[model samples]
Target: MLAERPWTGYGFESFWGTPLLLNQDQPFDRAWDIRTIVHGHNGYLDIAVLMGIPALCVAVYTFLVAPLRDYMRIPLRKENIHLGDFFMMVVLFAALNAFFESFFFHRADPVWLFFVFGMFGLRQVSLRPMAVRGRS
Candidate 1:
């Protein structure tokens, strides 16, 4: 699917044509030029190189920075429940999963979004404090 859209072309010309300009007199043939840049062999290589570096950075941040920040802000030894902390954890995981899917997979699915919402609902239900206090 990603192969279909060249940044220079209008619709389908770049993917399935003679690679010629429809309008030679114009300042530029936008479609042919963009198609050349995006679908050409060297263009693909350039995109791969560009995308790979940032992807690696994000991976490191996810596995390293996130856990470290979580540990520093919240004491692991405490048994008391904090609603905000739980919510943050849920959001972090959901966001990370979404980011991975969008970056690596190149496809969007609603299942991850559903999972995020489900986690939020479950966290809210579980963290609700009991209204009655030791009267029974």
Candidate 2:
């Protein structure tokens, strides 16, 4: 299905919902049945299959790259270090989980919510100054 339309993709929920799209010519001895699979089980592949490679690229940057860049900039001070560390763990957890689960951008999902929250926290921490000194 993805091979047939790599650029355009099969659209949302088309993976298992569209049986006609599956390769009907496959041998009966095949190990896995494409029809039985609902989601790609991988966030990146799900995005590519649901939308397209372009959308996958955008999602990758938005969800992974941008947040990581912000995380790197957050100051490691005693006051805000915990904030940065906690959010970093959340980002890492989401990133690692994306490989095994397809819950990347689901707005209602807790994983997605925490991931977004982590991004927001990282951004806020990155933007603020580490310390301030008063002048006489």
Candidate 3:
């Protein structure tokens, strides 16, 4: 599918709405059907197919890579460690879930919302300096 439109793609809803797949002259003996496919089932691939590879790269970097890097740099305090763990879990959940679901970047998706909230929380936690509890 990407080979057909690597850059511009077939546009949104192409997964099910595209005549490209529906119009295929498949043999009558075919076990499965393309029309049954509603989504790419992989969030990253869906974005790449619907948007483009560049958009997929940007989305992955923005939502997963950068935030994970930032969270890793956070100081290892009791509270900070907990925050990092929470962030890690959220990131992992979203990342792993994307492998089988097309929920990434969906505004109304609860998982996507939680992922965004986790990213925002990580940003706030990474910004504010950890208090120097023992310092004068």
Selected candidate, larger TM-score, 1 vs 2: 2
Tell me model 2's lDDT, rounded to 2 decimals.
Answer: 0.80
lDDT of 1 by residue, 1-136 (tens): 3333333233322332334433324445454444233333332232333344344456456543554454344433233135435545655565455533332222354644544454444444344542434556
lDDT of each: 0.41, 0.80, 0.80
All-Cα superposition RMSD per candidate: 12.1, 4.5, 3.6
List model 2 lDDT by residue over 1-136, tens digit each: 5677778887776665775746556668998766666677898889898888888899889888998898778776765777788888998898889899888767798998988888888889888855655688
Across 10-126, the per-residue lDDT of candidate 3 in tens digits comes to 677665677767788878999988666878889989988998787888988997888988787777677777777787788778888889998876789899998888888787767
- Report residue 62 deviation for candidate 3 (angstroms): 1.1
lDDT of 3: 0.80
Displacement of residue 116 (Cα, Å) in model 3 is 1.2
Rate residue 111 of model 1 by lDDT.
46
Descending-TM-score candidate ranking: 3, 2, 1
Ranking by lDDT: 2, 3, 1
